[model samples]
Target: MIDVILADGFSMLTTTLILEALRFVNLAHRRKAFDWTIKGVQSQSPRASNGFTFSAQRSFEANAEPAELVFLNASYFPDAAASPELLAWLRNA
Candidate 1:
């Protein structure tokens, strides 16, 4: 499984491209080749720099399970989205 951490003000284009690429891989394989979860600092959806919201599957937690791969999506003012909890989680991950 892959975990995509959606920081506030994340880059919509980059995020979409990554997701679509993964989706295409699965489509080409004709099966669910990869599974991923979108995570955010909060349970609510994370807003993108373009004023769009993307639904997050879950919030970051200290005890959350680590994925085989992880991607952190951030854009403008990315440092603003780095909470201590998130930093800790990333460190452990």
Candidate 2:
């Protein structure tokens, strides 16, 4: 499965388009071509730069499931630097 680590303040358009394209491919092929887990740095929901927010399937701390592929999604101009906890998680992952 693909693990998508959506950083806080991610672009809504980027997230939507990627997921939509994946969904379309699955539908057209009539099979589960891909599976994804959207995760946040923590259990709290992440928000888009436009103030839109959504719940993640899991958090880095809460879930240790190994992933075949991992992706980081973040919008421009992040307000904060990557936390040490997140850096550690990435290193270990």
Candidate 3:
């Protein structure tokens, strides 16, 4: 299987959430087969509790905004629908 990475922006955007998940996943120390459903989201707004939320991290802080990837939680993404464009990018990246 050709495992090319997809939109780096998307990956970068999710890095924090995913890495945190990975750490928790590893620490669990058991081969669990599932995860709990996210709660408290009602709409498509970034402010929605269970959906993706993005914020710029450049204010006053020394880190450059473009260079900063911020993810506040794991429930940041919505349903995982594999679109054709995403597949293409993953295959070609």
Who wins the lDDT comparison? Answer: 1
Candidate 2, residues 1-93, lDDT tens digits: the string is 877777878888888887888789899999999898888764458887789887899776633755787776777744353777766666766
Candidate 3, residues 1-93: lDDT per residue as tens digits? Answer: 111111212334444555457558756867642332221112222232323443422111112121123222323243332445433433443
Which regions of candidate 3 fall more than 4 Å away from where they truly are?
Answer: 1-14, 17-52, 56-79
Give the lowest summed-lDDT range of ten residues in model 3. 1-10
- Candidate 1, which ten residues in sequence have the lowest lDDT sum? 37-46
lDDT leaderboard ranking: 1, 2, 3
- Candidate 2 similarity to native, TM-score: 0.80
Model 1 agreement with the true structure over 24-60: per-residue lDDT tens digits: 9999999999999888865458889899998898876
Give Cα distance to truth, residue 52, candidate 1, Å.
0.6
